[model samples]
Target: MKMVFRWYGEGNDTVTLQQIKQIPGVEGIVWALHDVPAGEEWPMDKILDYKSKADAHGFHLEVVESVNIHEDIKLGLPSRDKYIENYKKTIEKVAKVGAKVICYNFMPVFDWIRTDLFHRLEDGSTALFYEKAKVDDMDPMELVRKISDNPDFTMPGWEPERLKHLSSLFEAYKNVTEEDLWSNLQYFLEQVIPVAEANDIKLAIHPDDPPWPIFGLPRIMTSQENLRRLLKLVDSPSNGITLCSGSLGANPRNDIVGMVREFADRIPFAHIRNVRVYENGDFIETSHRAADGTVDICGIVQAYHESGFQGYARPDHGRHIWDEQCRAGYGLYDRALGIMYLWGIWDSLERNKQEVGA
Candidate 1:
């Protein structure tokens, strides 16, 4: 697995490329244009600009975390055609910059849902937390306000420009059902997979954040069967998955190791992280260590290795440790440590193989 790190561009992020470079085996950054609205073409000059920065740092620009899907596409509106064309243009632009994969999600309104951004852990470190009961109890706007109230930095997915229309956005999806979402996603993949293939860029859809419906919105990209259906939509190698452990693992039945082995060839990108799932349906992001969380970090890595994966992977959301004043769940300290933990698993597996062969 070729490891990458998520970098939210130059000034937008607290973690620096210099710090990222210090992490062993991290080869590139998973990035995006935060200011660019969905459905608009990504500017060519801007794409090359990030390319220049990556070149300067000697880091590969192999994967982008998201080129968000326009809501019209998910809603199956007529305007979605224009948005698909724009997405094709964006894909072409990212390809020019040497990107091999573009990771995007199809969740209706919010990209990822969480009740608390800095939920304190027993060890005093804090991580992203999702409270099941809270999601059902709070108003959607109230939840949005709570998450966006952070004064430190503007949270991703909760962009003010987008959330400004939260009511309308949620209203747009009221009539849409799970089958409708699947059909819309298929329509989208049908249009874009050819473009992605032509550009040698794999279009990887991230699994639904909690692998379930939220706020009465239909979420189809939530399970293995749905994933299988997604691939069959395009029936091309360019059509694939991001294979995020934390996102799909929230359900406790995802069998991440099995998923990795099954979808190995289709997955060109991975979001490797762990989460502690409670019997109450609440969940919290945890360290990459196996013992610290429910997801089998070691087994997942071994499955990727055994599958002969030559794809890009990254350490996903990490705890805020050492009192790091950074983005919620994206502090450099824990993530860097998580990188070492993942690398330890990967490297140890390779060493074990060599020793056995010897």
Candidate 2:
């Protein structure tokens, strides 16, 4: 596995490229043009600017966390064709800058939902938290206000401008269903996968953040079976999965290690993070250590090692440790420590393999 770090870009992020460079084993930056709205073609000049920055730091711009799908595309509206064409253009532009994988999600309304941005842990640090009861009981507008009101850093999926039309967005999806979502996603992949293949960029769809529907939204990329169906939708190598552990792990039955072994070849990107799930259906992000959370991060890494995964992976999210004031889960301290933990497991696996061979 090639370790990468997520950088939100120069001024937009608190963590600097210099700090990211200090993290051992991190070879690249998983990035996107945050300023570019979904459904619009990314400016090649802006793409090259990011490329220049990463190149200056000797980091490969191999993976992009998201090129967010517009609601039109997910809702299967006619305007989706224009957005789809723009997406194709963006794909071609990023490929020019040496991107190998583009990670995007198909979740409608909200990309990922969390009730709390800083749910305090036992250790006194804060991490992103999801409270199922609150999500179900609270008004969608209230949830939007809580998340999108943050002025310090922009949250992915909860863009203030987009959520500004939360009511209409929800209205647009009123008639949409799970089957409709699957059909739209298939339509998207069919049109885009050929372009991805041509550009040598794999399109990896991130599973729904909680691997379930929220606010009555139809979430289809939530389970192993759906993921399998996703790959078969287009039947091409360019059609792939991001295989996020924390997102799918919320359900406790995702069998992440099994997924690694099964979709090894199809997954070009991995979001390796841990989350502590409770009996009440709440979950808090935890350190990458398996003991800290419910996810079998060790076994997941082991499966990747055994499968000889040559894809880009990142320590998906981290707790805000040492009072670091940064993006909610994109803090530097815990994630760097998480990277060490991952390397410890990966290195031990490598040693055990060498010993067995000897």
Residue 164 of candidate 1: its Cα lDDT? Answer: 88
Which number leads on TM-score?
2
Model 1 lDDT tens row, 1-358:
8989999888888999999999988889988987798888999888888888989989988899789898899999999999999999999989888889999999888889999988999999999999999998889999888887885665667778788899898888888989999899989998999999899999999999999999898888888888988888889999999999999999998889988988999999988999999999999999999999999989999999889889998888999999988888888989998889988988898999999999
* Candidate 2 clashing pairs, residues 3+ apart or interchain: none
| Candidate 1 off by > 4 Å | none
| Per-candidate clash tally | 0, 0
Looking at model 1, report the run of 10 residues with the lowest lDDT sum.
Answer: 151-160
* Reference-based TM-score of each model: 0.98, 0.99
Q: List per-prediction Cα lDDT, in the order shown.
A: 0.90, 0.92
**Residue 249 lDDT in candidate 2:** 98
